[model samples]
Target: MSVSEQFVGGDGVISTPIATGVGTGEKAEVIGHRTADAKPSGEYASILADTPLQADEAGVASRGMYSPLTSLCNEPRFATMRRGHKVMVGQNGWLERPGSIAKKPEQPKKAGFFDSLKRIAKEVADATEMKSSRRVKGGERGRASSRVRISLDPREQSLLYCELEFLLTSALDCYINSQFNAGRLDADKYKKVVDAWHQKGRPKVVGFRYDLETQLDLVFLHMKDFRFYGDRASVPAAISGILEAMRVNARALRVRTFCQPDSVMAKQLLDSQSLLNLLGSAEQRQIQLAEVVQFFKIVLEREHKLQRTEEVRGLPQ
Candidate 1:
């Protein structure tokens, strides 16, 4: 049975891969579609091919919702390959025109390829329960049978990135909420920051579709002006607040990563099993919290140094 059929509890159901919207200069061709009714309960399935798939009335109307093969690309927002550069889908529209601004030259377009494969492998693992696939003998055993590789299309990759962005935003909100609940952050500050985030901060990040380090920079920028209490003693409280925030966030992220459906962030977290599993034990949680604090400290100090250097350069050089 194909992995997808396993998802919907279907077996021995031969699914023909269908193509849709072929040779349409404005649209993308897609592959891998099982029959509409072939998919069992509470799941959506569609296939895209070089040519459009002829589906029943209900399927025909819904086909455009998921696939880039026809209507998805009809919206200018869907990421498309242009001059070999992949575009990013924006929350409301296209983040960038493919060649408008060159992205970091060194960064690769298909960076999430392996991550998608790993996510599918993890999905298979969870579906079959890897423990059952294991053969514990003498000293060594065979690898688990619950492993598979998947090559994601550019459209799929864009969707995964969008989902991951949403998850990160959710995690950040949880962290902020934890601090607010602990009384470490002022109510006014919390409201203002969150409002600004939803109104401006998040939209900006989503627009850029930043990398991890750039995202961290954005976080620091947002938090730099944050004020809880204007007192020297409050400095320590501020740090502690953020430390607690990160601790809570890390644990929440761990739970979310394991329980949520397969995605890019989940795959990244699973790859770093130590970090993902840290919250399972008290000692590990403590260790992870300390590392998070140290990392925050390093970033803060680096930013301070850069500011100082810039000031000095502005004055003399």
Candidate 2:
């Protein structure tokens, strides 16, 4: 018989039976398993194709093998879901919160030399502007104050001079009387009393012009002695009065200097006014009073001849 006719007879099989260990004639089907259907078309086809459940076409895949790979593509059931956000492997594991990653801290920016210079310059400019504005306001206030007239009439000036002279003589007399009553100045209190007396005397002598330089020198020495020993806390109101008197003297001297252009008295009064202002400023209060007064006296006693002029004559001139 021909080979095709022999193989094709009745049932479709080889003429001779093929050898088999598990089955003879036909292969056995496994329970609960079947050949997977050929992949579906359209969207279903694409999904199955993309899923890892589908093996490469070159390999044979079993129907029972779908559980592991297909699990990856499934939406997890709420009942079996885990409680944290999914993270990629090898990403930072530290968390700022239970569900979020910690962010990296940014570095502080460093300033350059030029940047520091710019900041300093801006600060200096702001301070200078502020100071200038303050100075302008002060000048305006000074001008406004100046408009209130201070009469320098001869009668008024003479009365002021006489009152100051009386105050000085009265203070000296009071101190002498206290000394007499205390039965000779106590040894420990002697220096204090003497200093008080000198302190009392300085303001009185400051406004006057001396006929001889010796008199001015003696008064300057007395001022130094008083400042050295005078108690600041117990500083009498008379000291404050003296300071005010010095201020008045400065203002009056300025006015007189302007009105009488050819007067030595005005020049002398100006020098005395400058010294008083130096000693009376708020800053001078903190310094060693003796040293401050000494410096003031030295400046005042500098050798300079007074011009001979009859205009703006002082008391007893």
lDDT scores of the candidates, listed in order: 0.33, 0.28
Tell me the TM-score of model 1: 0.22
Q: Please, what is the TM-score per model?
A: 0.22, 0.19
Tens digits of per-residue lDDT for model 2, 210-302: 112222232233332233113331354544444454445434543533322112222233333333332322222112222222222222222
Among all windows of ten consecutive residues in candidate 1, which has the lowest summed lDDT? 1-10
Query: Over 4 Å off in model 2, which ranges?
Result: 1-148, 183-317
Model 2 lDDT on a 0 to 1 scale: 0.28
lDDT (10s digit) by residue, model 1, range 1-317: 11121111022221222223332223112233334333322222221112322212222244332322233333433333247454456433358556655545575567453354344445534533432333443343343322222223444434434444343443333333222223233323323333445564343222123333233333344354323322322455444444344444444443433323223333343333222221121222223322322222232234335545876787521
Report the lDDT of model 2 for residue 7.
12
Query: Best-fitting candidate, measured by lDDT?
Result: 1
Model 2, TM vs. native = 0.19
